[model samples]
Target chain A: MSGRSERVRGKLSYAEAIREALDIAMDRDERVVLMGEDIGVYGGAFQVTGDLFGKYGPERVIDTPISELGGAGVAIGAAMTGLRPVFEFQFSDFAALAMEQIVNQAAKLRYMLGGAVSVPVVMRFPAGSGTGAAAQHSQSIEAWLGHVPGLKVVQPSTPEDAKGLLLSAIEDPDPVMIFEHKLLYKTKGHVPRGHYETPIGEAALRRIGHSLTIVATSIMARKSLSAAEELARQGIHADVIDLRSIRPIDRETVLASVRKTGRLMCVYEGVKTLGIGAEISAMVAESDAFDFLEAPIVRLGGAECPIPYNPELEKSVVPQEPDILEAARNLVQGRI
Target chain B: MPVEVIMPKVDMDMASGKILAWHVSAGDEVSKGDPLFDIETDKAAMEVESPGDGILRFPVDEGAVVQIGRPVGWIYADGEVASDPPGGIPSSKDEFRQSVPGEATADGSRNNISSGPDNISGKFRASPLARSLARADGFEIATIVGTGPRGRIEAKDVRNYQARRESEADTSDALAVSESASGTGTPIILLHGFASDAKSWTRLESNLGQRPLVRMELPGHGRSQILKAVGFPDLAATVRQTFDGLNLDKAHLIGHSLGGALLLDLANARPDLVASLTLIAPAGLGPEINGELLAGILRATRSESLGPWLKKLVADESLVTESYVQAAMRDRMEQSTRAAQEAMADALFPDGVQAFDLRAALARVEVPTRILWGKQDRMIQWNHALRAPGRVAIHLLDGIGHMPQIEAPEEVARIIEANL
Candidate 1:
């Protein structure tokens, strides 16, 4: 095969890619619709909706009042009727307000109806802290929804993944949660043009290494990558697997890396206890990877407290590059 | 001719066998039916006789656990020279080839070499500065090919591999171009399918008769550039350039599975470069494909790992030799091979369904085309043969499966010669 280096094309901001996905799904299928607070007229809290209000008009891109629960209920109801509705949450923490509609109705309805009805609803939560939106505005609540059986939880780390995952989330048979890290909005990366699904339940191997495997999600996945770079500086090579889909979590890829590295490090901005890391840690501990472990599995998650209003404290409360580097070093060295 | 003495399938369900002992050394002479090696299967320990009279060649040392159908050694008969098997498998220098798997020395483990800031010994042959920089960045120092004195992985090689800086070399030559086809006989371009290389066309090589062919290893397959992130069009363009690189304006194109679709696109993209087209159970004509086979070959580290998948390639499971399986596995271990293969597979057959429907393209092509398919093909349906244009020829062999070249090489080679 001719080995010409792959040419990078079509750079897009994370926000632009999400909006592009919305535009693509709507243009391709008449049944696809967008509904959120100010998403139609004001262009959303984060403006991820873009100018869809003017393009697709009011009926297709409906603007709703500030009622996450009510709007979520309507979206779930619309999904039951086979109209693909992508409901937007102003922030992920707001998902707590719509737990009844999202978890109980949208998620369980497919099985609850014995496969007679499907709720193909996609919910986008502008998640994670970086804009100093404090606890309410900047929470990554994927874990809360990930714990539920029927709902698919995901956190797209780049612009490319954001667009592809959003489109796939729209076509899902059940509710798929898209937790877009707030800070990643303006970050630019090459996004493939056209409709393509970055298949859910598959972890993206960001980089390869042999010393350890760092399982990271959302913003933490990027931070862990930088941290992995630092680890490589001292000759510590690590395999960084971006847990794009938290639910149906790709256990095969995780186990495979752990089998090679003999060390595991879970990196996420969620709370340390009962977060995604705990599940991943338990997955390895429960699997054959436990016997091959050179060091105890390490989870560099958020502290056991709500994210603070103070920016410095907020940064300290969650895992960062330095924290990931330190933890990876310790794990690789068997210092744990 | 050197004959590979494989780990015989002692039982109907035998998975693997361990070597009890080898009576001969690397260059020792042996004869047919002689006591060659002692093997221990789950059933019992038995002596394996020589398959041919030749000098014994051990691919691995004693005490190695080999898959049920693995070629542990070879026998080069008198009056015949021993060469690498017909398949284009690169010679392996795997540490395990000299010892048993899981045999770790006190110095360090062969399977898992420690890297990062924690362990960069001088014996590793990496520059201290490059090692330090790589550790600080967490980039793979081993993945970077060294260009310094004695092939030391200098700071620049690591930088280049990372694409941190661009230079004269294309991404592997822009990143360029695999094994030289015998001689400049006739530059016939042969493209293999996913998880396959130029070597898959081995059986046809002898019978092709004086036609110089460039048996191209598909990216991620053999000694070609591993474009881990290339798309179908880019791949087609690369093949088109292969014609130019060989200074051939046009040549006969033969592709299998994914390669079949690729050649079609090349003919569509640049018909002048492709004189004639021969597709073997090609993809893009239908959506059906074997998901398990793709997954099996991609994940297999050894021949055993490819057992079930290799068997699905043909109607007769017995044709799936240990040497063939090892050859497939060998090409798989090519550099950036895993990433390249995975990317191509995901693009071409996402969710086990062939992504593109080339039927429309087939109807457009004016080139002389022949679609060869095995009626019993379990990978891609032979019914896809019906999609061929009226002008295009079709041959559906009754007994073969996905691989028509390996099963009916004589017929296939004759078809190529006729097309030429």
Candidate 2:
């Protein structure tokens, strides 16, 4: 006897993949919950949670008070108990308010408890700029949470990762912070139909090369991958490490590639100073991998300034694909 | 010359302050410290002061939101002739061009703040002050993890959270060790040799296969930079501290060489903490030790030279990887590590002879004790296995060296698992 053919292929937006994950999780486990502002009847600000309220009803798909702190606290409380809550922030910019609940409480509770209690919570933030939401609304803060301890921070650059990581995050015993790039919500990709769990804290080698290791996360990962493809045309082979999970970051994978290429350029959309690049640079410095580095670790991040409202100024603020290619060229040539 | 009057980061977390009302309009002369405008922040509303004595050339309207550290208006200092306004509205043009709300200003340049998500309404709602301050200083509010009431992105939350996050990231990145441990068995305590920590047992620990084990630095290794003259008493104190920190009442004790000796010391000092003892070619059993090997271990300068010395402890030379040797060398070079090693070598193996002959202590140890010895052990002679008390069990492996725990982990684990 053969198993029933159940594989269904369909084109779904990034937003839809996330919604489906929540839907599947809620369906399988009644303990799963959804909490965020305007995530109820309004179907969420971006409509990523469309009709979830109607399907799961009000208790599971809760519309929390207009307080990020309060909502995060409630989610954490529920997670500490038995339920798995997927808390959402209308925008990633709003994640700033819930830092204490996230960084101090949720991220640390497990380690502090000596792994006695498992915190299975998933906090979602809509990140990135490109829809011209201006300064306050259009920002990518994945790098911030990725720096915290106890918390597993993940950025799904593709629909498949979004679905897979979301499932993994919801099922995880520790707290997980998921950053969904705003521009990527509408972008479509192939998402397998099944309950799949993507390994957290592992870097995905998107495009393999031997010239330079481009360590990128979140939206910048896609940008770096594109830049690597473009650089490949000019004979500059750039290996791209898509850091799906930032905290407990896959240093082994990054170091392995850096050791082979002998060069590294960490590219992220966050500001340059203490961005992900700094962490990667310090990792290279502390490891035996440092001796293998032929070129100085290069960091290409957003300009050290607030994002601009003007289209031209906004474009200038962040490192685009071309900027990454230029940096990669310079790094491989020993220019910095 | 126009003296630009920029808004300041009034509150600790304020990124942008909205201009509730511009007190002085175009052509209005204002003195230093004079109320120029009423700015409102997420925290509270406050008035901005004029920087100098001059005509108040305001470019932005009364209700405009001005960013922190952005020139909102200009004060023409006495005797300094004002240049022609770039945008035409004389009094307002200087302020407008110089502090055109969102125009890049010099109050605090190069502030890169990460942005947040796209607005579903297609319109982002932020105070005017936040917008202008963000633009001028280049602050991305998105990168800041806010602690505001309701997740409202505030300026103070951004700065504080950023600093905290950066510090945390720096610490973790600097200390890069694989954190996750795999295993599903009772907790086992693995102690390291002299000048080494739990990391030395990383390979053996991985091979143990699903047993909750915690490998920690002995007194002066890894994070435990303890300083005390290395002796059985000092080693016992370090082991006690580790057990208290981990809240472990009883654990299966596994130690290699110096660590093995330390385990015996712990058992002799506080027999209650040890569930069972697995000593891999321990030091306290025999009076006979290789003086040349002990001296070589203490004086080896380069990792290359030390590699062969370390290989002598293990039956299998394959266990001595370049990275492993480098890690050992690095640990050996630490001030605390060096001190601990020298003190331990002197205390345990003074004059290249076992300092504490624990044959009597072995008789008193009620806990089931097992000792494994390598026949070809170069560090400590294998004949020590025969010196164990009548009650203690001893296993002698042919061709195995001093570090059987690392070289012959499978056999050692099988012996440990049987006891567990």
Candidate 3:
């Protein structure tokens, strides 16, 4: 949509846009603060919290203990006490250790207290695979927290959206889990200045087409756009919908595209079975979109096996741009 | 002219920077390397010095996060005047931005998803998907309007649109012609071909006694409301709407000429509606159609001129009765009716050639379909009956022309009743 292509205004990397959102939110609202291990002096694992720690100072920008539970517990406690704490997980894989605090405390405190308390906690997880972080480091665990009703799951594909959605997430009364793809940190695009919200549950139509529709999430959304362009050259147009928000999936937008093209392919970096694609497929199947389908719906997610340490093997586990293109061609050709 | 100041990428990993405080305010004269502002990166807070000697100006708020390579402000040289500011950070406005303290954050109010792609909030148009779903479910999308942007039919709109169909279609709409309230059998849906209407079935009506009949005016023909545009899909959809509105799950279809093609389209679109197919001189058999005969029938205001095209309907001149010529001439005299016929002819039979192909639809038909044609039919080529798929029962009569029901009603009736 009229996103990065509006004009040649300067470009900012995904990491930079996120930092800008944090700076704007914290500066405007005194209650908003930052917390995580190695965030203050060492920046962040991916260095997303740049200069934010230094500007807000030690109290507002906290560097916690190495223990995942201890760090996550402090952030959740801060959120309960009328504070908007944005906690960063050095690696999304580390979220497993802090699940108790995230799911049980930060997510439930507002409801458990019967509306008396509000946990306006925003947790940022440097998720996804690309840099061969191996099994322990690279994992797309958004579905884990997304399954819990109390948490809102969001993945911003563009630099502009990353800034806007993160701002909205911070303002949300409930806990918002922001899954930032580690490989996407260096990607750049035009970002709007100041503070503006992209809304939490809305989906963005990245590219329009008539042949087939692709519902993509996170880095896969970016990859799909490229795949769509390549497909366009071959006279095969592919529609792509960037599923910015996962839990509150925009069914109308997805179904609308599916109806137009009569074919749908879900591209995700998470595990194929019972992942976001499964949810989307089931949603369309149950909805009226099922009747419009000319071909069986396809989902190209990661392999069932754990991410390998080898570079080539790591690339093979999750779908790449080529993989998305192939799946789109297969779906349109009625081969699958 | 003043020079623009940009946020510098201080280190390899340094992504974003914030202005903690400005050492020099706007209009403050400064030399190169002079301290301009105190900036902080993720690693450290440092004072970034001015690069040129001029009046220092700020384009961004003190606390706004400025990305690397983005213009943060401008530096004006001595004796230079500026009128407008640079284009905003992806924003096309002269006003820099609201300050952090003044910035109003979103309350996280989730807007209605169906407000369309760009937050366009009123009126609902059925999205392609909602229409496909509606078609697949055998629901008319045009009748299923939702409260989306301009009544845009989102998926929920189609589902919710189904709830209103049963009661809404029951209202007094002049389009339907179901006389005997109770359907005694699979009601035979009679669709008259081009340049014709329900009066064309007068002879067949008496021949098939006690049989159920659902007479439908294919929109804008008789009492039905005129369709604004008569495309192939639109015409098919109109008949499907009337067919669905009747609440008839299955019906035996007896279509003549283009009406036969419409039934084929309906079967292809929604095969569940037709129990048996009976096509009399259908259009899709071949691409050829007699333009002169069609144009002459619609243009002729006198029974004398209309008698010629009427003669071609049967093998013998005796079938062209004075009453038939008068009835056909009477239809052409209505200004509105003639205009609708003209539009339908141009759309359905463009440039005197049959514009549509129902051959693909023939393969989709699962019902026991039969084709009846007179060997001497002149209006639509009788050879069109030759292209009918092998499974379709073909009966080529000897003496009859195009109007098989009128020239040979007993044989046509027997063929239709046999399929039942």
Candidate 4:
């Protein structure tokens, strides 16, 4: 394990890293099974779970009905019986159909049961839009799940993180929801091909800077980093944190970084109103971190309107790197 | 030798037990079955007996949560005899000396910290001050190595280096902007997208704030002269004449979407007028445009019709306001605006496929180009934005979609500001 950590090599896409993580986890634990729609024979819509069915066989790599609710129920049931189950939603948008099973049941089961049973379930969902999937298939709704009390929500931006966080989620005794961005699936990053874990409820500092701390999740993390690069050209260093897990949020990591930077900008694909940004902003406000903030916590997100079909209008709705960079500039300059 | 003591699992649901009380401190000798400490679980508080007859070393303080089957305190057995039963407690030093491989080290080094650098990539670390300063100054730490403690770089180093470079460049930029202001150069013109008007450029316009600026709503978009029937070429012609009407041969053209596509067409048709082209995730590149979003833009007669569709463009839906949707529908209601949207949607994206492939057209242009795209662009993939002319530079902004110029106007302005 130590040898693998020291052996840094070429770049790998986010998809490859996730696959490697799944492969290692399955190999290490026989009880770890992956079940979802088209996950077995189809290898998933985005191909994030490519070719797992053949290796793990039908029992471990079970494919359920077209029902998102049914699949979630099955996973939850399996978890209650001592098996570790990883459920996948064809699209995160479909999670709305399974809200009762997820928010009401999977999330509250362990806590409400007086800790008698542990829900070691990991549900993976493809979230966000960029492929012209439009309103039905697009949308970033992780904030909704994060709002649930007992659920642990995670969004891994990088391949290595996808692998580490997935392993961690599998090991956790409580239910964990993993929101994977559609655009990031094909993106590659180097990943260790062994059992590893990134502790849940911790944020990873992707890029270090002081002018402003850009707290982002899932695909937004990549955008924040890109904006950080652009900001660097302008002589503004933006510290970026990938809040991998939304619920059980690593408040310590976010607050510590914000305390140093004195400025905070929360970026995400979700709408600004009642979105993840609001929660983060409130978290900062409620903590001592608020005193350290030099500027108001700025949130860069999708326009509060329906995503337009016109290519031009669609581009205008969501938060972009240029938007992030510009927001950072304004915050650093006290413009906002 | 050090002996291990673990919090007993008092109940089945009890995952972690807390240390309620400690009877002895470090260096204290202990015998088998000695009452070491009191543990508290979700059920109740119970006394825990020592595992070995040795010096006690309680690492965790009272009120620390410990997992079952995991050692919480250590004891030195010295050379004792085996007497305690398996379920009773510890017996002798040899009996307690059984080492569990891969268990946490006795030094408490592996607690809470990361297990190891398993899949983490690259050595991207810097001091908190250095990171903040670097971000503030827009410096990329990956390009520089640290010299501080543990090879971590400090913010002062970044500031010193940045100050030197900015001073050298500030002199030249000031002189150029001043020269342009003195009538040596023409004003910059910014074009807004459909349903959006000149106000979209307010952020960037204010930033370039210095140069004389002219912003117009395209025939079907803002307050510009509305058109009856508009297409890409028609919009391009109007934009070209708009520059002509302003009495300027060529000014910097910064456009978003329809504006961007129009600018590209104009730059291709008359390369001499355009000093540079800044395209914000412009269309006319890919054939895989989202038809549903386009249909929503055209059929949206009211906010109810347009709200959900508009929200699809961004990951966040709050940006979609009833007023914003109403304004979009109102713009589309205009006879000319409706025709223009229909014609452009058909001409640019015909039957769910992009009709125009401007890569070849852009290849013939010689103007310096800068392309900006949102990674989350739902209408046209950022991949299409990369099809600029050979010399054109591309910046893919994540979390944005087709109309980053509006969703992130300030960002569009900053990128343009940097280019200027």
Candidate 5:
């Protein structure tokens, strides 16, 4: 962990970084095991598992049948006993299939059993819309699980956070859900080698500004950062906060930025009505930060519909860089 | 930190008081217990003593109604700079710049501070943060111009307005002129007195027909910049500069009170600029003057207290209307303007006595001269007209006060035309 923080380990794609984290975790802990459909020999759907199955063999990197419910149940049972199972869901939309096991069993067993049992299961869901995955394949369901008290939900926007947060999720004694945006798989960033855990329940301030504060999650964070850059060129600056963990949301980070900027705009891929933006807006209104607001709180979230198969419609459903730019400009310029 | 001067609760159940007058001008040195200002409650008027010994600086102009315990001014130490009282409520000092919800402009005209679509609801649309800032800073929401949708006032608007006021306070010697002229030939320039502006000649101007009329707004009045001068001559020079800018070879000059003094000086110094001279209850003529009435005029911030003082300008109270009171209130909108006028007042009427003797200037001017004084004028003694040169025609009208041009505009106009 110390070496990773000190050394420059070159650039790596987000998918490669997550694979490197799985490789390092399995090597470091004997109890660590990987479970998912076609993950072992088929290199998984996105090729994130890649050649890890050849190196770790069938026992450590086990591939399950195409049953999300059964796969998630087995992963939870293994975590409850001794093995630290890392379950992979082909698409986050499939989490709806295993909600009974994930939300009721894996999330509440530790609390209901009076802390006598622990479910140290790490579930990785390829989330978000962008690649024409249609309604069934692409969805951002982090807020759903984030509402569950016993589970830890996180979304990593960069390669470094993707690797570090994965390592941390596996180490957590409670069940942790990782919502990794599929669009970010090919995006490359400097991912330091070796072990590093990005602590859960913390946010990343991507940009510091005085004009307005922007709270974004997952892929929206990346888009907001780019939007902030463009806004800077137009003489409007913004504070972009990447809420990495939604379950134990970093209230202080969001509140402090709102207080300084006197304006707030939340960008998310979840449905616009009751998504992460609603929670953030409520938190600000309920806190003293509400009084510091110079303008009304704005939300730039997904449209009120499922992800479409048409690429143009899919892009329109969620907040893009241009959407972020316009909203931020309106917010800072007092036009909102 | 400077010692704050707050409105004291003189009587039980008194929530607020109207400032009657300030005994000490801004930057004046005083010791503790010295008379600072006079405030009148519903029951009685009383003098408020100084709280500390230092240079005095009043934030609120005279004639303003202040709530009890609210700061009226500050007493800074000898070398201390006059910053506003920390966390204290700002009132008249920021009146011109800070938009208060539902506040009428200086001209008694409302400017629709909130031009938002919800204006019909009579509610100001400001973000929670902006509302918080305005509340903390003691700003009125309705007065702030919103830049957001539906004319919603945003946080930046409040901050920017505050910044503008702070910068305006630091500026000096910048003139704000309002000029209007009709008819042809040489312009007949009208100069108003203290606490008066170009608008004061409205009645007189209408009576002076078929000639160009140029109304020169006095410094610290109307839109004119706050004058920064030490002596009467310096004040005259500033007006002279404005006069020279007109590029007129010669013009008929009509002056009232302080304006009369300035015109007399101008006529003596530059005879070529004076075609004829008319002085109306002019100052710089005698020692005896109504000090209380002048102080009342300077101190009044509210129309209630100001109306009575202004009624003293004419023998009949009917001449002072609600609109006229409000128009006078506009001249006191800015605290700096009040301070500038107060400084000039102190120099001219140190103890309610005229300081300058314009008899020599009046005698030296070769232009035709005439003096109009109301027999019932309470501000200045009409008997001062006796000191004018034998060549200068003097008219003392009955049932008139200091403002002969306003009370007897037709008669004053006829006298001016006859002199011309």
Candidate 6:
């Protein structure tokens, strides 16, 4: 029924898709460069870069010292001078150390310089919990960068989108931030061969239904899709929207779905307070879709606390598939 | 650059404002501080003044729920070419407007209710959508029992309430039919056309005095219950049951349009109950029908849109009075009644093609049958009367449209008397 399912060739893990994207970009353009801490020799903290360092050599794939602020600044400066730099954060939590470069410099350089110099830099963040990395290393801080206007933030749930969106992010003129959920790196799915760009700022409709709309971001989108499958078995169908991008949010897709389903539930792994769910909930409330809501809008996000070291506590910190199932069932059955 | 007209932040805590109405349309010259539009905030509805004098170009339609400080329109200065709003044109302009009628007024009521924690103030805990649906369908939300968390009223609750109310109305109507059947002689049962009720036969009924008369309201019309019949046979059976319930051995059946088609089916099914048949511009003769006119009537929500179609029912437009238009509008006000009529129209006449063939029903008639047609009838053409058998009587009235009863009541009454 969907053209996306028909276009697939073979299966690849989400981590492999990112590696292939970097390989294709480097071969296509000499201006493309990779910069990060332990990305060259150690083959990335999560092994996403893999043997790309050996394929591209050290000149193209350069590893930096343990200074995120300094490394990010250098990448942003190289982007202004025409080189396409793909920077990876060892963990998304360390993005806090480079906030001065990402938030102020990379986000506002072009607008501040009267649109003379464009930043074509792409940053990959290994975000989310369930790895027992504790609060310091395992955190989803994509929302912080997403709040900045000049930056384009994306979270690809599927391997196809991971490859397609990464390629597109490399091609984007503005500084793009790609938040790769650590849990989704090993998950495998059919990835379309060659260079394909899943346009950023557009939300993908994973499942179509009329009972309600479930808008989920990053890894939460995967969990929501599974929950939707269970809901369908119970005769409670929901439109599952995988919000691949968050910065230039897909307001139209979300609004259109909410209008059809007459209910909305935003599921994300970010902190519940001012996370992506809050923005989405507010966006619907302020749009015409508000009138179509049959039930109260729901938000099932990460608990308002740091990620714990214990595996059980870590799972409880963020929303799981069961959480999505219960919330969707309640919203659709009008229990909430 | 044109001065951008934004949805002003009226209240300190207001996140969005709904533009109730645009006082000035596009391309209108406006001065600074002139009333451009009225916006409804959470607290109150207030008129927002124009920021600069220019030609107002509303990129956004009225009733749009816009975020505070977002530009809803742009005021182009003299000799300055117009441009799109910075936010670009919204794909669906009127999507946010309330689908319900008579509730668009800015009466300080919440223009758009939110499911937020702050909006919960009434005795019930209904969802915003549930409240809107109930209000639109003319149901009091307080009366609806909630099935949501903490006894919150959900949209499904409102829908269940409507279904229960319709069934209750149906039961009372059945009682009224049996109780009202008190006449002595063979009764003249009159059935109305599609989208019409028993009240439509009032003009013809007054002329048939001293004769036992029974005005039967078809399902989905007047006070009758809505019947979701499978086919024409099922619809005919329903009318037949109503006749049988009256304890009448036989009835002189008179039907018009859709009603005529049903009576023909009834006579074909149970010839004993039908003493005689008077079909007036009835459906089922051919596939041809004025489906556009039928659709226009069903879609019309106000008198202005409905009056034109009602005027086509008669050759003389004067017969389609203001009261007639208002009466039809009032009938359509009930959501269930309108829905039932639409379902019937789609089943009987799909895409203007009559779904049934009653030529055999007319040919196999054992009893006396009369067909009335108007020369100026624009609904079902008069040519259909030519299909009638030689044994049947055919009367084609001059200067008349679909409705011979309203245009030439005396003539229609005389023809029915001849059949009797």
In candidate 6, stretches whose alpha carbon ends up further than 4 angstroms from where it belongs are A1-9, B1-124, B134-151, B157-420
**Model 6 TM-score (B-chain only):** 0.63
Best by the TM-score measure: 6
Model 2 docking grade: incorrect
Superior by lDDT: candidate 5 or candidate 6 = 5
- Candidate 5, position A97, lDDT: 93
The TM-score of candidate 5 is 0.53
lDDT of 2 by residue, B288-336 (tens): 8887787787787557777888877677887788777866776664332
| Fnat of model 3, as a fraction | 0.10
In order of lDDT, best first, we have: 5, 6, 3, 1, 2, 4
Candidate 1 interface RMSD (Å): 18.2
Better of 4 and 5 by TM-score: 5
Choose 3 or 5, whichever is better by lDDT.
5
State in Å the error of residue A99, model 4.
1.0
Task: Arrange candidates by DockQ, descending.
Answer: 5, 6, 3, 2, 4, 1
| Candidate 6 local Cα displacement, residue A91, angstroms | 0.5
Clash total of candidate 5:
17
**lDDT: the better of candidates 2 and 3:** 3
Q: How many angstroms is residue A296 displaced in model 4 relative to the true structure, after the best TM-score fit?
A: 2.0
Across A43-137, the per-residue lDDT of candidate 3 in tens digits comes to 89888998876788898888888988998888888888889999999999999999899888888887888999888889999998888889988
Cα shift from native, residue A236, model 6 (Å): 1.1
Name the regions of candidate 4 deviating beyond 4 angstroms: A1-10, B1-420
Per-residue lDDT of A1-336 in model 2, one digit per residue for the tens?
Answer: 245555555688899999999999999999999999999999998999999999999989999999999999999999999999999999989888988898888888888889888789999999877777888988877778877768888888999999999999999988988888888899899998868988898889999988789999888889998898878655568889998888878989998997778778888787777778889988987986765665456777777667888888888878888888888887664343
Output DockQ, candidate 3: 0.04
How high is the lDDT of residue B367 in model 2? 93
Q: Per-candidate DockQ versus the true complex?
A: 0.01, 0.01, 0.04, 0.01, 0.20, 0.15
